[model samples]
Target: MAKSTHDHGAAFRAGYVALIGRPNAGKSTLLNRLVGEKIAAVSNKPQTTRFKILGIVNRPEGQIVLVDTPGVHKPGYELNRRMMAAVHDALLGVDLVCLIRDASVSTGHGDRFTLDLVKQSDKPALLLLNKTDNLADKSKLLPLIEWYQQEHSWRAIVPISALKGDQIQELLDEIIEHIPVGEQLFSEDEFTDQPMRVLAAEIVREKILEVTGEEIPYVTAVVTEKWEEVREDFTRIYCAIFVERGSQKKIIIGHGAQRLKQIGIRARRDIEKMLGHRCHLELFVKVEEDWRDKERLLDQLGVGKEG
Candidate 1:
């Protein structure tokens, strides 16, 4: 919550940049890499990020506030609609847009749809072809680069491997150049804007995504109902995992509630790492039929609230 109030001088440039892309495009990976910390929860599942997470990157010359958004996808339920709205919301105030694409895959209708969203933003953009390390032959990327060039006259096109940190400095340099000269918006030490409670919930959800099958992640949501720092080096948390049906709940619980216990163990480890303290995490599952469509539950869950 601390802002950098001192003047950073005329050489400094700081502004918000939206990392817009399709699902599983490695936007969160890039954000974490840029900020040098794991503030956003990452998984291979589509639409893993449901809110606009602000990651502050401090440079000697400037600061970059990266706004990581939910993936661009066809809205189905109310949750999907709210997720898409977060993407649109990110575009409105950003100084630049970095459209992240998975270079290892073939471009399709979804890619085009994402590009359309960038075009609609009417802001200067840089095309970042993420996951380039997945390519065995780097020369094969020329065609994909050319295709994007023909689609839109971008400010710059940079190929980067977010996972392996390839060409990341070049990408950062390009980003710093595009943003206007201004003072720093956030403290240099502050990496992200997410509260501990929201992050705890996301960590539990990420564990669920990691262990469960395809269908469960889309219908599931996690809310941290309680968080208390019980001691100087220990904390206690109680979280609720809401599913749309009893069958889904059963799957999450597993036989003798083993799967749920595994989720808590994994989540607690990450939470302890983040807080630098031992944590007692209790996870409870509940069936909330059609909860995604319920606005009140969504409000309580902080969906679309960051936008």
Candidate 2:
């Protein structure tokens, strides 16, 4: 329950805050809700966020810079190792840590892995029991909160539904309280720090996550090859979707290229909405022979230390 002694309400506050939890625990959804925009791509699939994405929330009184990271999971591949590294790096130099838990489901080993990371951090940690709307019994929340309070002396334990916009403002107020007194970390007009190329890749990857299920989800990665502004009102974007095997590529393309068409159509719409411009998007499928393990390819995709 350790926290700053400064009067946060009396002074302007600004600092970095990280959202960490088990896979599919609604951490990305909660980040989007707090930032008031879809800065992070979310899917029903686990491990959707592959890197640490920064989102800014500017309030009337304080500013919070949210570092949205990949879900906590065991590393079975080089890609998975890079993802876990992002989580460790985000833990450094943060004012507060908000560990979200999927309240609707029973806690398990993955949840324990996240809790252990929290125990190692010296920052003030806040436990957000997200997706409480899915709970059948509202009375179950009290015991849930009490149990977590004993687990870790959190600054606050708040129940919220990030999807249904329930108690969102209350969570924001609690977050502002934990931030220390300082100047604004980012400008008032900015919402996220993600570059255009990375966001395009993420948007395309989100479509892939939604369109394809099974083993295809983990074997896929998107790279934006070209981003050209044809005119002030128009943009032409081309991206390549890399898979480890040719069969995987064929599955993604589908019969008569129907599935690829579907992915492109859905992804283009999201890209247009995000960029606020008319977009012409082209998607191509390629077999990279396990590109995730290749350090050279991963650096190009923005996962290396210098990347």
Candidate 3:
């Protein structure tokens, strides 16, 4: 990462922007695009982001610190409650809010619920109709945009495709324009606030989401128990995959432990890329018996921790 050479004069602007929306609404994807890095994990699964990840974007005019939060959903467990808390915390400490919605899907109660959250925030917000590239009938966007406008007096309504880099620069420009004038909060070289251990655990968890089915991903959590740099170019990592039931553990391990093996291989590749060094990843599956409801474990994992 390089330091910012951008001007920091009277015209400069900077602020935190929260990415809020329902599950699987492309919030993580949009964050990655805006920050120009994969600091946040990406998966098709809903609630893929369990914690709020901050990614810093340095530009000529301003710096945008993006808070990528977990998908908004009803709380059913301690974990869910904490995730929602993270969302609320982000809403309280931000200069702007971005309500990202999947335009391809028909509007429903869930969408309205998300909008209600934005309304309660009472902050300047931009309604981003994401996944516009996936819309088969582009004409339908007009009605969708109209509906959002009618719901709230948005600062701006921009239809975008977070996956395809569509209108990303325009969105950035809009963000910088709306934020208040201020000095940059972080240095240019800083991209994300996530620690390397947390990132490694997230990458391993993302691999679990990618390799397994829906049930496994939601019921599973990965924690990096050990990280050691044995050499300048080689690192060793050990992660524990916690599951709620023994049967689920069997599923993740798979026949002859091949599934777990595959997950290790996939996660190591990304971890190595992130570390810029060779990595030896070790994984172990453990049955935690409904760890999502355990407060101590959640504390250790830093889930729902205050920003």
Candidate 4:
């Protein structure tokens, strides 16, 4: 990752900055943009981010570890209950908190739920009105900002387009000021802390989310079963996509395994680019009989993992 040249002799400041919002509220996009890497899983589908994704942003003044959490929403399944737990955990012991809201969407119960969390934090928090580009009337922003202003006293509020990279520099400028002075937490060159196996599974899961529709993506979980790096330039990974029932397995594998093959082909391209190694990606479908409800599998999925 390329970083802006900063005066190395100057004081270094770094700390954790949590990005919280409702589902599909652009938290992943903002993390990717701020960190200058595609490490987080992103999809139009809700809850694309299931756990805390750590992204390191290196600036001359300081390094910011962006903590991306699963969107805040009412829990239905055991997995969702764990996701909400992650959101609460991320808010604790963080140097800063950023509540990212989709400016295009109207304020509702979900937004209020997130805002309530922000108010509870009572720490240095920034309200990011994200996806401002999607707003049909730019003038509507003033009222939206006013509403949040009335809701809580924020350190700063900035409207940005995470997808378009609009006003991001301004956002960064604001973020750095709030981060306390300290030494860099991570090496400047490092972009993410996720291991290759977890990332590989996430890449496959992202592809699954993109390829499938309805409840299939939500019902699915990808686990890396094997990773072989026998050669300097070649690697092989085997992953199992777990579903609740055999019928869901069929949906993922498709007829004659064509859909699964497509998933592998597409995922390998991204895996190779991210790892800079030729990867032989293999995927398998398995029915885990409601694996989301199984506590053991949840542990393997990085649930209850810290930021």
Per-model TM against the reference = 0.95, 0.95, 0.96, 0.94
TM-score for predicted model 1 compared with the true structure: 0.95
lDDT of 4: 0.87
Candidate 3: list runs displaced more than 4 Å. Answer: 1-10
In model 1, the runs with Cα more than 4 Å from the true position are 1-10
Name the runs in model 2 displaced over 4 angstroms: 1-9, 304-307
Q: Report the lDDT of model 2 for residue 14.
A: 88
Candidates' C-alpha lDDT: 0.91, 0.86, 0.90, 0.87
Candidate 3, number of clashes: 0
Residue-wise C-alpha lDDT for candidate 1, range 246-305, written one tens digit per residue: 999999999999899899999999999999989999999999889889988888777876
- Tens digits of per-residue lDDT, candidate 4, 1-307, equal 1123333465768989999999999999999999888888899999888888899999888899999999999988888888888889889868999999999989999999899997797779999999989988888888898899898888888889999998898788778878888998888778898888888899999999989988897789988999999699999999988899998888899999888988999899999998898989989888878777777777775655552
Between prediction 1 and prediction 2, the one with superior lDDT is: 1
Whole-model lDDT, model 1:
0.91
lDDT of 2 by residue, 61-177 (tens): 789999998999998888889999888888876889989898888878888889889879878989988898998897777777877877888888878899998878788888888
- The superposed Cα distance between candidate 4 and the true structure at residue 63, in angstroms, equals 0.6
- Model 1: pairs clashing at backbone N, Cα or C within 3 Å: none
The model with the greater lDDT, 1 or 4, is 1
What is the RMSD, in Å, between candidate 4 and the native fold over all Cα? 3.4
